[model samples]
Target: MTSPLLTRHGAVAGLGPDAGVPWHYGDPTAEQRALEQGRAVADQSHLGVVTVTGPDRLTWLDSLCTQQVAGLAPGESAELMILSPQGRIEHVAGLVDDGATAWLLTESAPALATFLDRMRFMLRVEVHDATEDWAAIGEAVSRPAADGEPVTWVDPWPGVTAGGTSYAADPTALATTVRPWRLVLVPRASLGAEIEARLESGWTLAGTWATEALRIAAHRPRAAFDVDDHSLPHELDWLRTAVHLHKGCYRGQETVAKVHNVGRPPRRLTMLHLDGSGHSLPEPGATVLGRDDAEVGRVTSVARHHELGPIALAILKRSVDPSTELTVPTDGGPVAAAQELIVNADGFSADRPPKPGPTMKGLLMGKGCAADGGDLPG
Candidate 1:
């Protein structure tokens, strides 16, 4: 009933963050509190922020990433993804420009570095693992950035202060009252001091779970659970923003054009309302089933939302049917499942992250591990 990798203030991290909170790797309480009261902060020092500089930076990055980066006017940020030759996502990052350099922020894990190396083939670009140099934080507000800038993080379930107000004369003044700003901090050693400073400065720090659920609910895709080499960029609904259809060719360009113009992927990411009955709610990787225990999908995350009871982010194949009443096999028995999706007023499906990896079976399936009381590797 606890997340093995999550932490609350890093206190019970390796020790577990207690039972009430759901750990997707961070303190679920932080997230829960954030959703309930509109605020919380997370320990994002574990993510790497790669800075790309030089005159050739824009052209080099434009040729490598799926997002358009040639005209970034410093002080602008965009979520981006780098795809593999096969059209799978190699690395997905928040691409922010400070008017001088480009910053690619991703999980501190080596996967993104591996991606950067593969992407630096013939380009005159430099990629540095600034993980030890910066940290990131997100805040949701009831209004738009007071200075007139686009909110970097979009509220998935509504209630965002959305509007273009890039009117701030300075960065500090801009961030102070911004509607939704994912502030990135630098230097791993500076994370604690930075967070403390935010708290002292009266910034609302929501719990990690609340943040995760809000992003999931908002249909906003993010790292860890979202990017993998097998899934295409379009699958996560990053078409115009992350994946520019008119952009120059990148590693996955050929297949991307082919798929977008020709095929529809078999599965789609969805949100679900869970009954949370038998046993504790299933964590990520549990399989969802239709009638007769038919395989339909797998959950990416599950959190007890302050308002929505138990909710989940899942990937279900199209044949599974969005409205079908289903059950998901879990540690205990089966928990009831119902499919849901987020659609904006513009009729565009909001961003939703699919499972990072493809897995047809449970983590310990047929390994005799679970039966032997073995812990599963996520």
Candidate 2:
């Protein structure tokens, strides 16, 4: 069954009971439309964005995070990570500063706390679980960011939005930290009326399954599902920007540096354009095979592409060679697929050959940033 988290704001349009876990009935057509033109809104309240502060904030944060956090000015945003002792990712999140306070957003607040607790035992910082204290709404629109109060612009990654509406606690008076921009929205229920009145229009509610599909089509990775205990930053192409190799030690710095310098990870994630064969939905753990019908990898996440038929993400052995065409390893037979360079999958800076050659990914692909969808912010 889909947890309350997945189905909370989402639903199955034609059916009474919505899609099951993994949200199989994800709205591909609607998702693609949201990307291409106009806008589509999604609920992101399940993820928690907590605040960490105190005199030790800067030093403590720098020690706990994968990206350097020592010099962030108030009202600035940067993307960073937390790693397991083995160098695999725990969560890659955004760090928001309002000068006095710093916030971190991740899929699980409890999980995040556990990671932070290890470092906070002796540090003078306090970690607050502020997920319930706030609500989030995600928008993928071609329009520009809101125009009003000072906006906290965070360009942590290539296509992500930092703080469309960042809120912080007030020490003296009632001051709100919010903005109108391209991003996942987190509206405070305490001030729900004020927020609702602020944006009377231009918001759409997303069900769990639909939201998952939209993200997969964009070739984006969510914390737990897209990432796992074993994933390295490079597997998801989240290096340099998210993980700082030159920075001092963190839980998994040595492993990160070793992999980066060695130029290898067991698996390489890529996008696949499949036929959507027999209406067959390949769930995660389903096998991926090569053109010669040999096992290559497995599907991680899938959503029907708005314009490109069936699309999916898979991690295959890096040694498989670019010349090897891939197919779905299934009972019926190998499902034919074409290698699709995800619009966001940037070629390796160290190993990749020059481009204007092998297609540019992420927003720079097909029609540029507007190809897979639009110039919208998410």
Candidate 3:
């Protein structure tokens, strides 16, 4: 499944899920600058595509996902998550509907499609893994489809959609974080040609390195990097786009409701500004240590930004103070880090209702990830 675009001069293959795609095309810093300036296109053909059709597609999805999708309009896009019964995130996708078909762009398409297929007992929905037929490309903004009419899923990150609330310590962060992201679907067969055309038109080609850098800087979460068996929406600040507060009962609605209404997430997502004086960057799953030299969290993703130098996203125990300076063990030694809070220690809705009786707060704070399964993906 290696991308044909990888044939481009200077293309270097990525690893893991990003395998078969370009990690960078010689110069990542310049590529990142072009991408942020909206003059670059990044290859994202490794992403999975799932198509759901039939008259009941929207309602069936709405009943199962965290987002309210039943009334999704023709060109509207939204993010959704499928959670385990305990409210742990299992799958996440960007959803968009054409007049007749619903397209899901995800990192876990096979699993998502299989889950959707099994859920269709008597429902009229038909789910198909269209990953082989379609490929995706990332852009700073939506562009005209080449070859045919392509579906685009616009990212709604860092935005509080209707029935959603924020847990960010700085409310202005949501208003100020600007990532005009879009994923455009194209015929898989023509992807190389399409990119060549864009290149001819003066658009620089970026890679996963640039995209990951931008995503980390924006405090955005990716399923392949951020999620684990115990990942809760509140922990990642994902409720802003993925969960509908007032949606009808979905698989994990009860836990979702309880956490936001009366309890806080045991773990919080944070941004780490790493010491850039050294050449070493911490790898994903690197241990994050507090001043006491004790493990407090794990780095989920890491990237060296064009301007921000070394930065990473980590999930820490909610008790970790925002002012605490931390360190991450890397191959080149320990790198000093400073925390920028993505989700606060009080990882609950700002508009949570006052409730009486014992809350789940004590239970969650005491157990942490061990209560859900010892380890949450770093």
On TM-score, the candidate that comes out on top is: 3
List where candidate 2 sits over 4 angstroms from the true fold. Answer: 1-10, 13-28, 141-155, 159-199, 203-214, 329-334, 342-348, 351-378
- For model 3, give the 10-residue run with minimal summed lDDT: 369-378
Error of 2 at 367 (Å): 44
Local lDDT at 54 for model 2: 86
| Residue 27 shift from truth in candidate 2, angstroms | 6.7
Reference-based TM-score, model 3:
0.93
In order, candidate lDDTs are 0.55, 0.56, 0.88
Q: What is the lDDT of residue 255 in candidate 1?
A: 59
TM-score for each of the candidates: 0.72, 0.71, 0.93
Identify the runs in model 3 with alpha carbons over 4 angstroms from their true place.
142-148, 357-378
- Greater TM-score among 1 and 2 belongs to 1
Comparing 1 and 2 on lDDT, the stronger one: 2
The digit string of per-residue lDDT tens for model 3 on 95-169 reads 999869999999999999999999998989899999999999899884433334578889988788888888887
Order of candidate numbers by lDDT, starting with the best = 3, 2, 1
